[model samples]
Target: MSKRYTPREMLEKLISFNTVSDRSNLDLITFVETYLAEYGVTSIRVPDETGTKAALHAHIGPSEDGGVVLSAHTDVVPVKGQAWSQDPFASWVSNGKLYGRGSADMKGFAATVLAKVPDFIAADLQRPIHIALSYDEEVGCFGAPPLVRDMLAKGPRPSFAIVGEPTNMKVVTAHKGIAVYKTTITGHPAHSSQLHRGVSAISAAAKLISWLDAQTADNKAKADPDNAFEPPYTTLHSGVIKGGEAHNITAQHCEFITDFRLLPGDSKEAWLEAYRTFIDSQVLPDMQAISGDCGIEVEELAYVPGLSEEADGLAETEARGLTGDNARHVVVYATEGGIFQEHGVSTVVCGPGSIDQAHQADEFIELVELDRCAAFLDRLIGRLS
Candidate 1:
C-alpha cells in the first residue's frame, strides 16, 4: 500500500528537496512520479533540452474532455544572500505558519494538490482533474509551454486551468506580461581627450537607458488612476549594467539588461519594434559614423505573455464558485496562466498563501490558508463528482 501523507507532511517532503531554479528539479519530479505510481496514476515527464530539469503532468479520474487542470511550478528562487531564521529547504511550522523557501511562492499549492490526489481518485468524478507541475518559473516561465503542449497532446483537453500562484486564495483574472532583453553596444575606443574621435559605448548605453526610463515615466504619467493594476501602466526597467573598464579610456563595450512588464492588451511586438527603430535610426548611426565597426545588438532573453480577462472565463467562474470570491483581482507579476490561456485553456490564478511572503527571507504561508485551499479543493472535487 502507498504511504499516505497529509498536506503538511507532503509539504515537508517537497520542501526538503533543494529545487532552486538553477538546480535540477529531477529529484522532486522523480519523487512525485514514484508517489503517483504507488497510487496507479501514470505521469508524463517533459524534460528540458539538457534533461537536467523537467515538467510533469498527470490526469486522474475518467479520461475525458473538458477536465480542469491544477497548475503549479516546482522551482523556487535561490536562497543565497538572504538571512533566514532557519534552513530554507527544511520545512518548519511556527506560530501557525509554515516556513520554507517555496511555501508561499508555490509548493504549498502543489503539496495540497498532491495530498488530495487520493481523494480525487476515490471520488467518482464526472469530469477529470489534471495536475501539471512545471520547472523554471522563477527565472522565466520557460518550462510551461512544452508541458502544456505535451499534456494537451497526451490527455483529454481541459476546459479550465487554475494556476496555483500565491494569490491568497483569491481569484485573479489578469496579470502583466514580461519580456527580458540584453542590449550590447560596441563603440570605438580612444583617449578621453579625443572625445569626438571615439564613440563612448558607455555614453550611448546611458542614452539608451535614459530613453527606457523616459518611456516608463511617460507611461506612468499617462496611466489611468482607476486601472486595477497598482502601477496601472507598462513598466520598463534596466536592472543590470556592465561596461566601463577605466575612468580615462572611452569604454569600448557596454551591455545592459532591459525588461518590460506590460499590461494586458499591450503589444510586445509593437514595443520591441519601436525600440529597435529608435536604436537603428538614431543610436546606431551616431556610433557607426565614428567607426564602421561600431555596432549594437539586442537579443530577447525570455518572454512570458500577459493574462487577459476572458469573457465569461470558465476557470474564473468555477474558481469564484468554489471560493465565493467576487472581487476583481489583477496582478503585476507574470504567471504561467498566460501560457495556458494562450493555448485556449481558460485560466485563472488562485491558490493558498500571499504573494507578499514569496521570495523573501523567512518566507511562509499561514496554516489557515492551507486549510482554506483544502476546503476549496474539496468543493472542486464535489462539483466534479
Candidate 2:
C-alpha cells in the first residue's frame, strides 16, 4: 500500500464509517490503527465506561519531552432531517470541493494528516509528532478528557497541541468554555380544576427558565468588549424541554436542558451553584408548599473549559511562523485545546477549511483548503525537524 494518499481518498475512507457521537467509533479507530501499524507507530486507546467510543492516541518520532500534537475528533453529528443532495456518509467532490458529514467541522483535518503519512514517517526528526483523535466531540464535547488525563499520568505530555476544528488555516488563540446541564422538576399531580391541591412542575420550570433568561441577558450586558468573537462574551441558552401530558390534567414532570458558554476566568461550578440556589430558594419553596415531596434534580451533561485568553507564547509564535502569518484571532467555538492546556500542554487551534461550514447541511472543504492543510503539516514537520 502507498504510504501517502490524497486528501480525497483519505476522506473517503473516514466517511465510510458511521462514527456518530452516539455510536461506537471502533471501525474508525481500527482503520487508523491499521494505517499507523504499517509504519510501526504504537497507539494507546482511551475506552469509555461501556468499552465503546475509544479515543486513539499515537505518537510518531521519539517519545521525549516537548513534542507537538495534531488533534481531531472522530465523531460526526447526525445527518437525519438535514437536506443533502448527496449521501452524507459518502464523499462527493464537485467544483474543487469535497462534501460529506464532518467534511469541514473536522474529518478534513484528520484526512489531511493521514494523507501525509509519508512526509511524517520519512522525515528525520529531532522531536516527536503526536496524533490524538477523540470521540463524542459534537455532543456537548463529552470526550478527550480521559485520553488527555491518561497521557499526563504517564509523564510529560506534548508541549504544543493543534486542535484542528476548521479555521481556514489560521491560528485561533481563544474560545469560550461550555457547561451543559439537564434539570428535572418533580411534583404531585391532581385534577386541573382543583389547581391549588397539587403542585405544578411546569410552573416551577417556567420560573427557573425565566431566571435563566434574566441571568443570560445580564451576562450579555456585562460581556467583555472583545470584537474578535461573535457574541463577544459568555452566553447561555436552552436546547431541550419537555413537560405537560394533557391540557386538562396537572402535569407531574418537566425536564429542561441548558447550556452556558463561559468566558475565560469564569467558574462553571459557581454559575451552577447560583442556579441551584435560585431554584431552592424561589421555585422549590412555592412547589413544596403544595406537596411536601416536590423536588428538582440537576445533572451535568458535559463541561468543556474555555481557552486561555493569553496567546503571547511559544505555541502562538510557532503557529504564526508555520502558517506564514503574524495575525492571530479568537473564536467563539469551543475546542480540545483547553483540555490539553489544562494538562500542562501548550495548545493552539489551526486547521483547514472555514468554520462557517461546520455542522451544516451539504458541508464541504475546498480542495485548496485541503492542499493548504497538507502544506501546513508538511511545514510543521520541517519546523519540528
Candidate 3:
C-alpha cells in the first residue's frame, strides 16, 4: 500500500482484496486508511456494529464546510456462479481495458480519486475535498447511510457529493430507489389427498407473487409519459422463493423475497401498504379459516431512496464542466447518491465504465474511462483550488 501507486495500480491492489458483499472489507479499508495517512490526511473510520466492516471518510485541505465529497463503495458482488477466463481476484490488462472484480462497479473510480491525492494535497485549496468509501453497497446500499450520518454529524458537512457508481463518465441526475422485503408464510401440513385438512404455504406464496406481478403490470400501464426513465414507473418483482417438503405433503412453511424499484417521487410506503392490505383482508382470512395458527409475515429488509432531479446544480455543473457533457441521464439502478442527497448533500453520480459490464463474469473498465476520470479529478482539484 504505497502512495506512489497510479490509479491503475490502485485499482489492481483494490481488486486483489476479494471484498465481496458478504465478506469483511477491513483489509481494503485499512489499506485506504494507510494510503491517505502517507499524505498527512487523517481519515475517520465508520465501523459497523459487527466491527468487521468499516467505511473510510477523509478530508484534505481546509477543514471548513462546503467542501465536495468523492464517494465510492469498496465491496463488490460475489463471483460465485459466474464463469471467468482468469482468476477474478487477479486484475489484468487486455487490449484497452482493465479486467477484474470491482473494476467497473466501482473500485475504478475509487482508484482514480485516490490517485489524485497528491495533486489535491499539493493544490492551494480554499475548500476541502473529502473521500468517503463504504462497504456492503452491493447488498442494498446497507453500509452508506451510517457513514453519511457520521460525516455529517461531525459538523461543517460537505456541500455536494459525487457517487462514483459506473456511468461511463457521464453525469447522471436521477436514479431509482429500491425497497427489498422478505415474506414468510406458515400453514398446516397434511397429505395432499386431505386438502381440506391443511393449508399449502406454497400456494399462498404463489398467490402473493402473482399479486406482485399484477402490481408490476399496473405500474407499467400508469407510468409517467414525460419521465425519461426506461420503464417510466416503479417496478416490482419477487426474486427468491423457498418452501415445501414432500410432493405428497402440503407445505407447512414458505418464504419469498420481493423488492421494488421506485422512481423519484414514488412512495414505497403506499405501495407496501397496498400489499399489506391485500394480504390482511384477502389472503390472511382465507389462511386463518383453514388453520388458526397459519400466518403470513412481511417485513422490509432495506430501502435506498431514489436520487431526485430536485438536487441543487452545484455538483451537476461541476461534473458537466469537467466532462463537457450536457446530456442529462436517468438510470433504473440504485446508488448511494440517493442516500447522500436524502441527507441534505446535493449528490450526483458520474464515474468511469458502463454499468453493463458490472456484476458480470468478466467485469472490466476501459483504460480510457480511467483516463477520463483522472482528467475529471484534475479539474475537480482545480475547482477546489
Say which candidate scores most in TM-score.
1
Off by over 4 Å in 1: none
Q: Write the per-residue lDDT of candidate 1 for residues 36-85, one digit (tens) a residue.
A: 99999999999999999999999998889977999999999999999999
Whose lDDT is higher: candidate 2's or candidate 3's? Answer: 3
Displacement of the residue 155 alpha carbon in candidate 2, Å: 4.9
- In order, candidate lDDTs are 0.94, 0.85, 0.92
Cα-based TM-score, every candidate: 0.99, 0.96, 0.97
Tell me the TM-score of model 1: 0.99
Instruction: Point out where model 3 deviates above 4 Å.
Output: none
lDDT of 2 by residue, 1-385 (tens): 5456798789878988888788899989988988888877778888888888798888878778677888999999888898999898888999999999988989999999888876888898788888889988888666788878877666446888889989999988888898999999998898999998878888888888888889888977876685567787667678799998888767799999999988766799999999999988888888888888889999998888988855466777778888977675888778888888877777788999998888789999998998999888888999989
Candidate 2 — which residues are off by over 4 angstroms? 1-3
Candidate 3 per-residue lDDT over residues 1-385, each given as its tens digit: 3458788999999999999999999999998888888878889999999999999898989989987999999999999989999999999999999999999999999999998898898999889999999989988888899999999998558998999999989999999999999999998999999999999999999999999999999988987799899988888899899999999999999999998999988899999999999999989999899889999999899999999986447888777888898997989999999999889888889999999999999999999999999999888888888
Instruction: Give residue 215's error in model 3 in angstroms.
Output: 0.9
Model 3 gets an lDDT of: 0.92
CA-only RMSD, every prediction: 0.7, 1.6, 1.3
Q: What is the lDDT of residue 320 in candidate 3?
A: 83
